[model samples]
Target: MTTSTGQPLAAQRILVTGGAGTIGSHVVDLLLEADAAEVVVLDNFARGRMENLAEAEAVGGDRLTVVTGDINDPALVRDVISGIDVVFHLAALRITQCAEQPRLALESLVDGTFTVIEAAVAADVKKVITSSSASVYGLAESFPTTERHHPYNNDTFYGAAKAFNEGMLRSFHAMNGLDYVALRYFNVYGPRMDTHGLYTEVLIRWMERISRGEAPLIFGDGAATMDFVHVRDIARANLLAARADVTDTVYNIATSTETSLKGLADALLAVMDSDLKAVHGPERAVNGVTRRLADISAAARDLGWTPEIGLSDGLDDLVTWWRHAAQPAVAG
Candidate 1:
């Protein structure tokens, strides 16, 4: 398949770090569907599961290779990256994990990212598309945060690490002529979302309560808002970034629409046909950012990508998957 600009992925060799994770797995499927020559997946299985790659494995046959390894292992990363044309670096610790284990966060986000960049440059890969986060904006100074928005308000360890990775990519591009693109993802939710993560747990918890005929709990006044983007759309953005001619820049991968906690609860209840109202609890001690909305025009203009799923449709999809699939084990 070719991008809007006619960049063909038909014969490209691709490497997706953390390729068994939620978004990464979807990307692997897309790459195979696009008829890429070869797709290699390197992951430690810490947060990613092999079951996520079942579909890709069935479809890709000999075209896909899954390596159970760590990105921080320099030798392993180098070996995996060799002969690869494009690298999708999606391996990293979650925000809550970063907060709990700062040392591990540095090793994985900083050191692991460095290892991937070094390997990609050494292999002379065409481009490296990496995952950044909305955490970098912390409490945005403006409503719909743009790509140019300063990350001055970010104070979390995870945000700092992502910011550092972006800077590191830029430096590599300037010094070694390494082409790269950083995608700043908003709240991503879908079939395989992390059920135990601090951010996404709300959805799982709420649904569980609703299933038991209990009220969904909401901390504070339910005024805290976030920009939720579906995992499929996020995966599509990664492919678009890979195929686009633009490089050495970052873009916000989000649906510009903002939904408050209350709004989200209402939507879920409506979707499930539940009569239980959301119960209000005490204010959260660390709410972090109270509001989040992204400016996705840059992505649309440059990558020719826009979110295709609406929140209601996305939530319905998640609910259906949850009902059919076994309860996901808690993510470490």
Candidate 2:
């Protein structure tokens, strides 16, 4: 669904942390399309891109302000959050980065998020939509993992931080009456995807290699799968989470479909119109998880949201955008 169809958050002055990053950019774009009174994007450009904000800026005009600052800066967060109606916090260290630097991750994800919530509480903001990860599910033992799953498996520092943030939300909600929605996103990929972050989805890394006429490499037997969702659909999810009546709750943001790496590679090849075969490599233990598919019933039932882009269509859209962006421009 297009952003215009959503219930307008009348006179909302929203703040989207990391608003220039891959998924965050889409969030900002949709907020503008839904006619938020103003959208203030707070990002440090560590992973965020300036060009990503172009579309939002065009639509937002004077209503959009891009703040250059880190989330760990409590002072900056407090100042930026004033007069904000709601917040969509997406800024955080990558999973791999968090794994490599635990201390930094602690301060960034935990302290950083705490700072956001604290500021929102002080400002008496209306709502908060936190972007969490599916990593917390950690080697699911059941199909279509539901929100009622057991406490997060001690997987990685990134997952730990996400779980901690959820706790903080619940506590703040109980104590200070904070209204928030926590979304655990699955293996998300689309246009403006990042490969250097945490775990590079084999889809992107493979596409990069195949575009260079190399084989799409798969780890293990390529039997393991992931529930992939498009960034735009995720953007839509963020919007719904922001406006929906659902509060003090968590939902899995996914399309409820699993596609193996082999399947994903084949889809990529077909999209690129290439004939290269996939190369299977030795399996590494770090690749974790045999398969994953989210139980999206809660999101559908509570938020009235469902992902529209399927695997083939989403990958096609992603490949087209990536290919155009990767091409060298001729001198005008």
Candidate 3:
């Protein structure tokens, strides 16, 4: 498969930080499919699983190398980043985790990102593609938020970390001429989603309840909305960003479609063919961003990338995967 720029990924030495996670693993698989010369995965296993890289290992053979390491270790990061053509910096704590552990968030998201940027520049990597988040647009003032939107209202530690990382990338580009692209992902859901997490997405929680023939729960009348983009589409966006000539800019990677909790529950019920209705509960104290919809025109115009999977189709895929995978018990 050719990159978005129609250039083959063949013989390219790529490094994927957090490559064993959901979206990162998908990127590894796609990179291997594109016949990258060497795909090295550096993951500390904080949230990543070894099983996620099973398929890539089987298919990649000598082309793939899995390194058990931390991105915060400057020596380690520099060592692994050396001789790499492109770097995909995806390692970070979850949003909830970051909110709970501010110090860890600073170390992992802030310091770790600094290590990545410094190493990538020192290594003279062709391009660095990193994962940003829509959380940066916390409590957005406008709908269909664009990349140009400032992170003025962002209150969460996670959003602050992501915003800082983006700024660091731009600063590095200016000072060290480090080429980079940050993809601000929205609500990402698909196979390999972390259903066992303490702060899981509503989709995962609802699915677990529905599987047990229990009513799905929605918080605060289910008015809060998000832009749910599929993991596969996110992985594709990474590849497009990696190959595109764009640099020192951020792009929103989402479906450009808003989905409310109530709508999501209904869609999942229909997809799973369940008769259970959603139950409303008190709202949890979390990031209070009530609405999320992205303007993906920049990604489309620049990287030539657009989400191919609709919410319905993506939900069907998730449901299928959930049925076949182990169903872990989740707390309500």
Candidate 4:
């Protein structure tokens, strides 16, 4: 669980909101494995599942404590922040959900941010690493998107929510001297991704389709692409952000390699050893990104973060997990 640099990010105590999620669970596992003294996981099961923490609990033993609660509860957030050295804030509603219920979704994000950041500042927590999204770069003006091109590229409620979170963090830092970092994660793919959503990650849907002997569905032309970083890599980036000597800045957490939907389905087919071809579907998205690839140079230079799993290796791990996850045990 030590970083790739071999340095342990051992903490006396840690609090991870949404800790029972796809990426959050991996963050918990890595934190426990890296020898954190104690870790408290808080989740409401809105989009989180207890099964996601089974492996982490098995490894962490008494060192891990799970709490089921709402992140929007200011008092609850305050209580959870007490005596914690670090916080990884991953609680959120999905973009599709945000689009459907903008009022509730937006309120949840704004309310949750105030609760977590206020509690952290009140408790004098050492650092907080928050979850941002590459969707903030809607229709990028250039390839290799960087943090500087944000607010302009923000075109979705989901993206705006993340950007608002970042702005709050900066304001907190400026006013109260809160230490924080935000990672703008790109299209993350791996095991345990939420499989029930209508807009579930294309890769997960494709895997399920292949399992059912159905052809993978391609929405856009087979050419639109995204930077699909593994969830494990995303988890590792959080650790790096927590342990590194940087703050009040954002970093792009991605592999910087774009994979077309066709390429992804082909990769999955190859990995699954399936011969099924992808079926073409109507251009489903009203305003979908045609391409996105991040510039991870800042993460590398600042936090010593770089993705270790290549697409094929990541796909192999994902397929293995998917095959075992035939039931809905893990969270999104």
Per TM-score, the best of the predicted structures is 3
Question: What ranges in model 4 sit over 4 Å off?
Answer: 1-8, 197-199, 328-332
For all candidates in order, the CA lDDT equals: 0.90, 0.86, 0.90, 0.87
Candidate 1 wrong stretches, greater than 4 Å: 1-7, 196-200, 328-332
lDDT of 2 by residue, 257-298 (tens): 988888888888998899998899999776477888999999
TM-score attained by model 3: 0.96
Positional deviation of residue 115's Cα in model 4 after best superposition, in angstroms: 0.9
| Model 2 regions lying over 4 Å from their true place | 1-8, 195-200, 327-332
Report the lDDT of model 3 for residue 257: 97
Candidate 1, residues 38-114, lDDT tens digits: the string is: 99999998888887889998999999999999999999999999999899999998888888899999999999999
Q: How accurate locally is residue 170 in candidate 4, as Cα lDDT from 0 to 100?
A: 96
Q: How does model 1 fare in lDDT?
A: 0.90
- Give each model a TM-score: 0.95, 0.93, 0.96, 0.94
For residues 107-181, write the lDDT of model 3, one tens digit per residue. 999999999989998898888899999999898998789988889899999999999999999999899878889
Better of 3 and 4 by lDDT: 3
Error of 3 at 197 (Å): 2.6
**Model 2 error, position 56 (Å):** 1.2
Kindly indicate the candidate among 1 and 2 with the higher lDDT: 1
lDDT of 3: 0.90
